[model samples]
Target: MALWSGRFTASANEFTQRFGASLPVDKRMYKQDIAGSKAHATMLSEQGIISHDDAEKICTGLDDIEREITKGTFPFDINDEDIHMSIEKQLIARIGEAGARLHTGRSRNDQVICDTRLYLKSRISNVMRANYQFSRVLEKLAHEKQHVIIPGYTHMQHAQPVYLAHHLLAYVWMLSRDFKRLHHSYEAADCNPLGAAALAGTTYPLDRQRTTDLLGFSAVCENSLDAVSDRDFVLDTLYACSVSAMHLSRLAEELIMWSTQEFGFIELSDTFSTGSSIMPQKKNPDFAELVRGKTGRTVGNLVSLLVTMKALPLAYNKDLQEDKQGVFDSLDTIYDCLTCMAGMISSMTIHEDAMERQAYTGHLAATDVADYLVKKGMAFRDAHRIVGHLVLLCEQRGCALTDLSLADFKAQSSLFEENVMHELDIPSIVRARNSRGGTGDKALAYQFNVVKDVLHQQEELLNALTRSVS
Candidate 1:
């Protein structure tokens, strides 16, 4: 019989039982559901709502159920419908009346909400930790490649020269912002909904804050209906995940371009790349491409949840059950993607020579030569025009600016001294960007220190959580 079978005389159709069963998905929340029940049982006993001896027996039986599930020895039934009833039914079979007492002052509505919050909080913490690790790998790469120069692009056209480190740090900043978003999502899930009961507050005298503390929540939900009905926390997490996945997709897009034969700026490790089925000499960035493609599903999951919740009223409904699978899917998607990306970033080989070589083409140092003229007392606008004309002549003669003679320089502007050639060199052009936050050595060093400190703090938090989880 179903848990709510008291109100109905007829058995549920087989199709209905199979279709409505969430065991395939919500079964993942088993550990959390058991944990919340243990806390609630302790609270029930401590408040004299249930006998202390019964509480001990319920706790012991729940531990046994956890072991049975972990070892794949427990009988999981589809007709149990979801994780909550499955665990409760198992408890009753194991410990009789004490197991029945475990649900004192609670409804499956609040119970499911509580379990989902705990599950989501733990998952978000993991994603935050992975994001931190990915960011650290980026910081290390940026520091190692600080002196390597690359062409800066505007509209995919060479516009200036920038240290490759600066480009790497740009993504580090984006990931750091992602970490903040995950933190906010964690806060959204950090409240206790266990005492919300069905649509109204529980009639029993219960200590909601005690359960909240036992489970490590930051606060208890203030309103019963809001607590049970609110899947906003999960939506917030899904939204944050969608944004993070989008950021990763953007990075993956660059990795795809950079590893191409045309760019040749990076080489993916063999373990990260895949061979073509028929092509003779193909090393494909399939993992990066997958990361890019998964962004669509994660984003779609976010939109699905938002629209699902738009019309549902204040308490729990069947529509709310539609929330968990998408949330769980998005989390798993990004978690695996971030972990893989971190592995790829840490293992891949960088082609510094290729990066430096590309920086030298397309008149990358034109602005440096123009700056020399301006420093020699020409108006900035005049300097720009002089350099423009020099480039035009070089194009006309089918020669590079460096191939022109001193007379060629004198023809353009007598201000172009012999030293102009040295000033227009590629390395000099990169070194000239000495302002704060520029691509200069001093700027990269400063950026590295800032990123290192943030990563250190993040690592500390990860270690602490790992210890707690263990």
Candidate 2:
């Protein structure tokens, strides 16, 4: 018989039983279910709904169940339908009517929501810590490569020169935004939803605030129907995960390009690479490829949940059960992908010489050259055209613009002088950008100190949180 089979004349058929069961996937929620039950039991005792003695018995029983499940000694029955029912059934069998009283003013609708919120709070904390660790690794890499130079680009054409650290810090800032999104999602999941019974408030004189405090929730949910039917917390979390995965995919794509011989910007370690079966010398960045590919699944999980909830009516429905699997998958996938990315980044070798070589090939110093001519009293527009003509002459002669002699430069502009040679060198151009946030050594050093401060603050916050949780 099912938990709600009191008035039914017959049991569900095997097909119905199999189709209705969530035990396979929702068993992961057993610990959450147990935790919520303990909070509810404490509230009940406080509100005089159940005896303190009974609350103690229920709490002890839940603790025992937790131990049994952790040790793989608990028996799960297929007839229990879901994790909540399975645990409730066990509690009743072990402690009699006190276990039956556990659900006195509660329903599975709110119970499941409570468990989910509790689960997300913990998972988001874990992700935030992982993100902080990854950020620290990136900061360390940037600090190590502060002197390296690379060409910045626009439309795949050389635009200017920038420090390699400047390029890497760009992604660190992008992921910092991702960290903020996860924090918002965590706030959305912090409200307690345990007092809403089905689609209406129960008349059992239940103390919702007591349970809210016991569960460490920031507040109790405002509306009963909204509380039971709401899946927005899950959606917010899934959206955050999807966006973070997209960020990871973008970084992975760059890693793939960087590790290639054509780019020669970086090289993955053997542990983070793979070899082709037929090509003995081929070393591929398979980890980056996997991270790039896994992004699609995380995005799909977001769309799946959005589509599932689009047509559902008010209050709880069977359609809501479809919500858990996708969120679970998204969380698990992003966590694994972030860990893999951090490992790859921490171990990969940066090819500074190759970066410097490519930085020089694209005439990255052309802008500086044009500026030099303007400073020599040439009309700014005239200087730009003169440099443009010089670039054309270099292309026609199969030589770099810097390779032109003083006579070659004088042919384009009378203002051209020997000092232009120093201005057109890659390192000189990179180092000359002394403005704040520029690619110059002073700017990079300032930026590095700022990033290091942020890292230290992040570590301190994480340590404080760890102590509180412990």
Top candidate when judged by lDDT against the true structure = 1
- Candidate 1's residue-wise lDDT over 1-470, tens digit each? 97678999998899998888888999999899999999999999999999999999999999998999999998998688999999999889889999988888999999999999999989999999899989988888887888899999989998889998899999998998888899889889989999889979878999999999899888999999899999889988998999999999999999999999999999999999999889969999999999999999999999999999999987789988899999999999999999999999899999999988888777877888889899999999999998999899988998778888988888989898889889768777777677877887777788788888888887887787666544
List the candidates' TM-scores in order.
0.95, 0.95
Q: Candidate 1's C-alpha lDDT? A: 0.90
The Cα RMSD of model 2 versus the native structure comes to 1.8
The TM-score that candidate 1 achieves is 0.95
C-alpha lDDT values of all predictions: 0.90, 0.88
For residues 242-269, write the lDDT of model 2, one tens digit per residue: 9999999989998998898889899999
